[model samples]
Target: MPGKPIVSSNNAICLVGGAPIADDAISAVFTFVNSFVGVDGGADHLLAAGVTPAAVIGDLDSLSDAARATFAQQLNHIPEQSTTDFEKALTRVSAPVVLGVGFTGGRLDHALSVLNVLARYAERAVLLVDAHEVSFLATLGHVAFTAAPGTRISLMPLGQATVTFSGVRWPFAQTRMAPDGFTSPSNEASGGVVTIETDGPVLVTLPRAHLALAMKAAVRAK
Candidate 1:
């Protein structure tokens, strides 16, 4: 169902925010780790799903007394104007790897900001999960993926980092990629394994069906 999460994580945590997060998406947390929190509406969602938050962050603007009470012990009130609560969670996360869901797919502005944040903090091990895709900010290391022969892997540059890809339909050895210059998109996999190696920021998009496998690989990195 839409309310039950499909994947879970131990290396990753989830942030519930102002927008609507699917139940299936919520259940996905079971596949990973158990650490979760309510980011305003996200808290309410947690309670609705019968999941208590490990923490509740944000300005406490949209949070209610009930949601607050539900996550009282886990509540870490972050009253900062400099960044979003979602960012605070990502920033404070000490885990070696973090998988994120419910960060996108609700609003365009927030979705775009998620990308911006991913770019700004490419050094962090993070993956953004959406309804249709799973993306990570391609950083200085090697990102490897194995997709169906017809599956498409596309790259879009973010910030100061450059993208040099290999093992894909389009190849780049050591190339600088920025928002203004050459772009990589609609690239197809060559059957075995598809690897994208870069030193900066690039958005790696793949179908939702591949997210489970992709996340597993990302967390397995050295």
Candidate 2:
């Protein structure tokens, strides 16, 4: 039910949602993104912030009439109820890495749905970023990033994953992790480089200060 896909030449793209996004968060995302794709009412938010998105994608239900008219040329509507705006926008854009802002720190359900999309599209390197934290889905293979010693790192399993970690205070060697099972939260990095190896999907969370490192790992993984 989606309209024509919007392609981007840039390797990195930013997806903006309707949730309350901080000014600094927006700035951080723009720093890496070459193009912006607004999701549903997110177009309005971008317009208010003096940004014109490369394209707007959604169900066309939440976007205001004025915004729709103003951005008609860039609007790509998908009148389907089966998928969320985030999924629609994410699937339509082809980028090596995506920085998602305004999708976190909102209603709990909305934020959870964003994570669901991340797991569903684990092949895509998407980072859900907010003012304080940056998170991404860790798929199969090893991912390495640089973080200061004693930096906080949280490794949470999306479903079922057996993972081994290094450069952390507590290493999980072939540990079986599940949503209802064990998880590593508030773990400190033991050195400048942190590594994680998993056979399945997991979520890696780090402080905002490590966004650059996280982005580097994501781009490398792709």
Candidate 3:
């Protein structure tokens, strides 16, 4: 008898819509969730990544005729006039978290739109993972991390953030990033856990490679 086929599971979904996705971006996605979103052009990114999208949610404007044809039969085809396709996809997926690449980095307007979605989906635990950084619409909690001794971590404030950290090159205790906050860029890890205390949504980003490794570890643990 033939052996059974191997089946791998993926909860970490990647969205490659249209934001100039990085070459290494696909490595982070255990599963690719296609969103034929308009404005962001995420549908194009989906096909380019060679991933058979588990779900393609979006309006029809962003997708090219050929792209639409490619996914014609598979599309979930949400025609809601109010929600963006990206938002539509996020609503449909039941995953614990999402790593949304190609959702940033193209047009400035599109990038801003992605941010709006993040804020709206803040309660969804969706992390908008992009080439340059990972953004989250945090509500109330602490974000912590432990990486190899010398990894660099950067925090850019979106909304006001009351931040604190240790085990970093530059440690700040109860620091606030206000309307005009410090850059706090290029801080290195100190082989221990770094914590950020915040009451609202703040954009935190680190090296994508480290996050990819961590996500892989998470899958293995599960």
Q: What lDDT score goes with residue 86 in model 1? A: 71
Candidate achieving higher lDDT, 1 or 3: 1
| lDDT, candidate 1, 1-222, per-residue tens | 113232234456666666766657777656666577566556877787888766676778777788877678877666878887677666655565676767786788887787888777766667776566777766467767677777778788886556667767777777877788877778877677777777767788777678776666556344
The segments of candidate 3 whose C-alpha lies over 4 angstroms from its true place after superposition are 1-10, 31-40, 132-139, 213-222
Better of 2 and 3 by TM-score: 2
Compose the digit string of candidate 3's lDDT tens values, residues 1-222: 013211112345555566677777765554443322222256666667675565566666677776677777656566777876677666666554466767777788877777777755556555566665665543356556577788877666666768776778788887787647664667878887876666655665566666653343222111
By lDDT, the candidates rank as 2, 1, 3
Error of 3 at 221 (Å): 17
TM-scores for the candidates: 0.83, 0.93, 0.77
Worst 10 residues of 2 by lDDT: 1-10
- Per-residue CA lDDT of candidate 2, range 46-133, in tens? 7877788899988978897877888889999788788889999998988788888889877999888888888878888899888899
lDDT of 3: 0.60
Winning candidate number (TM-score): 2
Off by over 4 Å in 1: 1-10, 172-175, 220-222
